[model samples]
Target: MYAILGEDKSDVATLKVILKRLIGDDSIKIKTKGYNGCAELLRKGAKQITAFSKLGLAIFVVCYDSDGKDPAKRYSDVVSKIIKPTGLKNTICVVIPVQELEAWILADIQSVTNVFSSWKPKEINNPESIDNPKEYLEKLSRDCNRRPRYNHATHNEKIAPYLDLDKLKCKCPSFLPLVTLAENHDAHVAK
Candidate 1:
């Protein structure tokens, strides 16, 4: 079994979906340690690591965007504070900075404004300008091809773009390796 540790519920959900799609099994247990923060999770994850090590289960830690901090730095911190002291070599850590998880959930207008203060919506000089912001964002997302620039738009921006999640999955540094590992495991079992 693999363990996924992250700051948001959406990351857990997204990872679970991806794992299920790749491995053809939804039985992989995915637990969310905390919401929007990792300090406490890191502490509890330490205990979980020891237990998993005893069971000899392969353990992997996944974290995302420590804001502007380097992923290696964050991984080192988690290892030192949680994994290293536990003396577990079966465990490995993967971190994604400027995490896609955040973008997935906060793919809306108000959320975008909260992150990028300079954002503004393009003024639609029509009666439809009164449409629900969420609906507007959704339509805009579909029309703009889901680019990060759309979702991360400021309040002043009228349209939020869409990102090609499929394309992104392929490009994510951590994604291919995980998929390959799962595929190799399946292949070995078949042999």
Candidate 2:
């Protein structure tokens, strides 16, 4: 069994799709837990990790948005503040999405188009580089005159199933941890 932890419901909701696609199996028993937000995740993450570890969860995929902070530094913080203290660093994958979780959605323009046909995203060569991808997505939805402009909480999970995993991995560097975790799990299962 594997568990995923994210800053909010939307993140874990979207990740459930992504990780299932990566693993290519519906019976793997992937569970998700979400915190209120980044601050809450940071403050309470360690305890959650420790508790989950004690429960014998095989792996934990923890996600936090960088929120325009340095991705590497945020990754280090999650490692130090959450995983390291649990002494289960090997069982945890820390994914710090650059700027926000929406960046991963923006990485696949086709996915956005699949969700909203009217949404014509301006060429986003590097999604992770966008200053505020969540706001940018909302602007795109609004400019296209879509009813109920892109909301992170709703649209992220909506678009995730349509996302091209290859495109996301190529465009969003910080997304690697989740991919690595999936790959490692696959290897372990194969053996």
Candidate 3:
């Protein structure tokens, strides 16, 4: 079994879809848990990892948003604060989405348009560089006069399943960790 941890419900929800797509195996059981937010995740992650490990879940995928902070700092913090302390660094995959998880959402404009046909979002050249990607998406939805605007908590899950994994991997460098994790896990399972 594998496990996934993230800062919020939206992150967990969206990540679940992304992982399933990348792994291409619905039969693979993936357990997931979401903390309140970044602060809560950071404060409680180590304990959670230990609990999941005890439960026999070997591989862990932890998702954290950079939230305008340096991506390297975010990655290091997860490694130091969670993985290292738990002595499970090798089994843990840390995915720090630059700025916010919304950046990945923006990586595939076609997916967004497919979900919200009325809002034709412009292709973002550097989605990872956006300081507040969620706000950018919300503003774009409002600007296009799309009804029921973009709410990360709901729309993220909806758009995620349809996203082109190739596009996301190419556009968001931080997203590669999850791809690698999925690939490694798939190979292990195949063996």
Q: TM-score each candidate.
A: 0.54, 0.91, 0.93
Q: Pick the candidate with the highest lDDT.
A: 3
Tens digit of per-residue lDDT, candidate 1, span 1-191: 66666666545555555555566666765444434567665666677667765665565656654554565677677767777767766636455543344333233233344434454444232211233433455566557554444432232222222322343343344345455655665653443
- Candidate 1 regions exceeding 4 Å error are 29-32, 52-57, 91-93, 103-166, 187-191
Candidate 3 lDDT by residue in tens digits, 1-191: 78889999889888988898888887778888899998899888888889988998788889998888788999999988988889764478899998999999878866887788877766777888777989988888888788878888889999988888888889999999999988887565664
Which stretches in model 2 have alpha-carbon errors above 4 Å? Answer: none
Which prediction has more favorable TM-score, 1 or 3? 3
Q: Single out the weakest 10-residue window by summed lDDT for candidate 3.
A: 182-191
lDDT of 2 by residue, 18-136 (tens): 98888887678877889998888888888887777677776888898889888788888888778777776446778888898888877886677777776666656788888888898
Error of 3 at 61 (Å): 0.8
Ranking according to TM-score, highest score first:
3, 2, 1
Model 1 lDDT, full chain set: 0.50
Best by TM-score: 3
